[model samples]
Target: MTPSLPDILVGNFLCMAEPPPPESAGEFMAGKVGVVALLSLLAAQEAERGPSARVWENAAIRAVLTDAAEAYGDAFAEAGAGVDTDFTLGALDRANAALRRSLIALHEAVETAGDVVRDHAILRLYGQMADARRLDMPPLPGR
Candidate 1:
């Protein structure tokens, strides 16, 4: 049987000692879903409160997101065929890495930004990501 999401995450984390790579069509799809979900949330928040200075002024963040978006597009094109090739998996890995780096920057901004509401929102998103990571690998095994 296929492993549960958390189990897949944990197993990948333990075995690989890094973020889980998309090893199957389902995993690739799940990664895509996560990307879309975070991007959608960011878009909605920006639309409501306008873009944060940290987000707008950070060229690195912009470039990373743009690159990731393009990579995501490329991955999506191949996704229908089930990420069966090394090329497709490599593209997806690049996209995921870009997105993860961007998130780290945003989380750091959350710590320094003075805007209470925006900071809170960013923190919440960071928390969600952290929770996922926690599930990916426990802090102490058998605890």
Candidate 2:
């Protein structure tokens, strides 16, 4: 796969060595620049995907909610619906975590819906959720 230009750029910047000048380039060369550059790159990627990620993620959440709502229509479940797209970073993040947890529940519930087709669909959804949360959460559901 071709590396993203941003990644390539960050990689190049990170590979740069000290100027070998004043010799006073001491602490600054202690990986501080690399760390900051990587963080900046991460922030850039996050910003680029910020809106779309929330949109796609919320749709996933809503799909799960709707599926669960219909499956457990009377199961007294709590759906984390009505997410405001304009929420602050921290708040949106908290909602993201909550939605992820619910995704797990919805995935299992969907699988056990007593229908083969829906069961397969839920299995795929579970896979997608695993892909999305693989970095932060465990790969297995509920683990």
Candidate 3:
């Protein structure tokens, strides 16, 4: 006999545990359904896009940093220094945030000067910072 929703509810309410082994008819239909399949598909999609999205974001940041470094000369040397490190999704994320904040200053400085070369370069950096911020991972809560 197929289990009913009430039977399943009695067995595993609030994700307490697996539904009881309902030997009777009404209990059989009450167990969880294709949750595994849905979860599997979602996991696969996240795995595929996760790395490439981060890499692409890093590439965009790199392009902006490289340009700004050239334009600013030696001022941003340290900014470009550790940026090339092999960062996990987490570390790269933190750095991405800092870069975004830095882009604000870069924009202000370049905007006041109106130098075509620096102006255009800073524009690229601004766009990149915006893109990076959008792609940035969410912060983890303190344990």
Choose the strongest candidate by TM-score: 2
User: lDDT order of candidates, best first?
Assistant: 2, 3, 1
Tens digits of per-residue lDDT for model 1 on 1-143?
A: 73333344455445445455557458675665555454444444434333222232232334433443342444322322221123333343444455556656544544565546645654565554444333222243235
TM-score of each: 0.28, 0.55, 0.45
Off by over 4 Å in 1: 1-90, 107-113, 133-143
> Between the candidate structures 2 and 3, which one is better when assessed by TM-score?
2
Off by over 4 Å in 2: 1-30, 74-80, 111-116, 119-123, 126-143
CA lDDT, candidate 1, residue 25:
50
State the lDDT at 103 in candidate 1. Answer: 50
Per-residue alpha-carbon lDDT of model 2 for 1-143, expressed as tens digits? 63443565566565565354566477766555656565555556655655455556666776656666765663314564575566555555667667767766666666576667766776776577556533231243234
Highest lDDT: give the candidate number: 2
lDDT against true structure, model 1:
0.42
Regions of model 3 farther than 4 Å from truth: 1-47, 83-87, 121-143
